[model samples]
Target: MSIDRLFPNLTEDNQAELERFGDILKRVWPLKAKHREKLKYDIRDMSRGLTTERSERKIDYLSEARFLSPYLTYFLPWNLYRMSRLFTGLELDIPDGSEVADLGSGPLTTVMALWMSRPHLRERRINFTCMDRAPKSLQAGLKLFNAVAGENSPWRVRTVKANFTDHIKRKADLVIAANAFNELDWSGRVARPQAEKLAQHMAGATTETGRILLIETGVRLTGRIIAEMRTQLMQTGFKPIAPCPHVEECPMPATGQGAPWCHFNFSVKDAPTWLQTLSAEARLEKEGVSMNFLYLSRKGGKDWGAVRIISEPFKFHGGRAQYACSHKGLTLVDHGEKQRPLFPGQSLVPNWPANPKTDLKSGALILPNTKEKR
Candidate 1:
């Protein structure tokens, strides 16, 4: 079977609805079992304070989410939650085929799937790296890449064991941070170290399209996170992209259903098949995985801000996922959609003329609907 056939999407000419169906199926039979439930608990880890004057004390590469997925969000499928970030972050035109790096890449399978599915990026020579401190997780991530993408994947896959807390490594064109940040055990942040490490990489890295992607579970942390995230990324010289919320003293203020907070919930109807596929595909075989997430980001060199629209429908054409999301706060119809500058600090729209042009009044948001024609 052609690789593209396995993963689906929506398009202008043809739309596919079955892919969402497939994603939903996994919710019923999550591959992780109780571990999935455990991620939901907000309390600290039970395995902390294990050090003593005996037997090389070891902490699982986690301060929390031990035996759990970073932050438990049973509402949405974990994979889908990550995918939605692209639209929400206004990173639609991520310089196709550009070099991309995934810091603290966990179990490369999922991210690899993302790379393989994006044909536009495949044509570009991809410089890929996965860094993590845990040998087990790194090893698992390695195996994941090989299994998910056959033997002849094009991207250059490299692994390294280093602390994200310290400065290290050269950056690539684009940097990716999955759920690695929130998993830290340190006070202030479980993931802040990783973010700082990423900044170090940025200092040394040469990026044609300088950009960073940070996606995390968005349940309890939803309201709690909005402002803090904006501040941290700003410290790194980054701004929020469009189709997202302008949280950091955002100047563009208006009255609307506050940029929709994206939440991912597995399709209650599609869980069984997803569970069965996991056994043959990834670890936690024959189980389900779900995550409700909120993604925020500013595209490279853009002053535009963005906040994910929770619960947006995935529309397909023919059978491909062309138009997968519809950002909130903005609309397909611009007949006086009241343009509002994202923030008062905003001088002019950033990256204004790229593939994803922005309308100031409506703020940076998805361009009309991207849904495939049925």
Candidate 2:
């Protein structure tokens, strides 16, 4: 579906709000030559993964504006687009009047994305609770929410000043965390235990039929953490909904005998003018963003013999190879001439033969007569 169909009035509203935000930045911080130079340096540092300590400090420096400016102009659009793709791909059945909660809701970006994805919910008395440790960030998010949803919107919104690791008081119909899991230092000695704790909390905070969406940067460590959490959550009674067609243990975790990590990339075409300007200013490559995501629900018994493409299709002389994950395990499927190209995140239903040949050397499950459609 098109963006206009999925999110009525979102593009127009977003453009107006972005202009207002830009005005605020110009009025409050007036970008001078020195500021521009510092922003360039900070952007360079950020590209090299050297801004984590500065981000944790929470001090309002010029470098911070350098970061926040692009976040509003560039990152926000990409995030909304990504969330829209997830919602559409998963085909989630979110009930009307559902209560939604966002953890680490910086500037309430995810909440905005949710509202944009389900514009019908605006008339249904949905309740949203946004939680974050940064009060200023929450305040900014509230302003953005007001701008997008309006002051007299049917949706009731609330903000909380609390860290995500702390216990939450209320249960919700849908819970979303974007880029929050990767910040928990899950690569340390406490990785497994921390993942288990997070899974328990997510399960506790969701209703029986409610769903949880976790999105992280498509990095190896982040993918590993999500894989570990998926195992833990499944053990606690939740089932994988999207991206994974089966509930079996993830075969792509780093701990699983040096297997490749699980992550996917989505293409972004014709980015917004603001993002293009910011990219040029920061001297960052204008490439499509890669995101690692998981969707889980308390509902179970998904036994469909479906497969999900987990990697980019590798082209050969006259065929293509796709790595797929299913209940059986991870295996590559080779397609013959004139076959359609497969992309990551595309779901497929393959017509398997009564007797198929499996190549153990390459771990390829050759589907000679398989009729596949995405």
Model 1: worst 10 consecutive residues (lDDT sum)? 1-10
Candidate 1: count the clashes: 53
Candidates' C-alpha lDDT = 0.39, 0.67
What lDDT score goes with residue 73 in model 2?
A: 46
Worst 10 residues of 2 by lDDT: 1-10
Clashes of each: 53, 0
Q: Name the regions of candidate 2 deviating beyond 4 angstroms.
A: 1-41, 50-67, 256-258, 316-318, 353-364, 372-374
User: Against the true structure, candidate 2 has what lDDT?
Assistant: 0.67
Tell me, by lDDT, which candidate is best: 2
Maximum-TM-score candidate: 2
Q: How close is candidate 2 to the true structure, as a TM-score?
A: 0.83
* Model 1 lDDT, residue 175, Cα: 68
lDDT of 2 by residue, 224-322 (tens): 888988888887888887777788878677564456777877665534455556667778756666778888887753668676677777764477877
Off by over 4 Å in 1: 1-77, 84-97, 166-168, 185-208, 222-226, 242-272, 276-374
Give the TM-scores of the predictions, in the order they appear: 0.51, 0.83
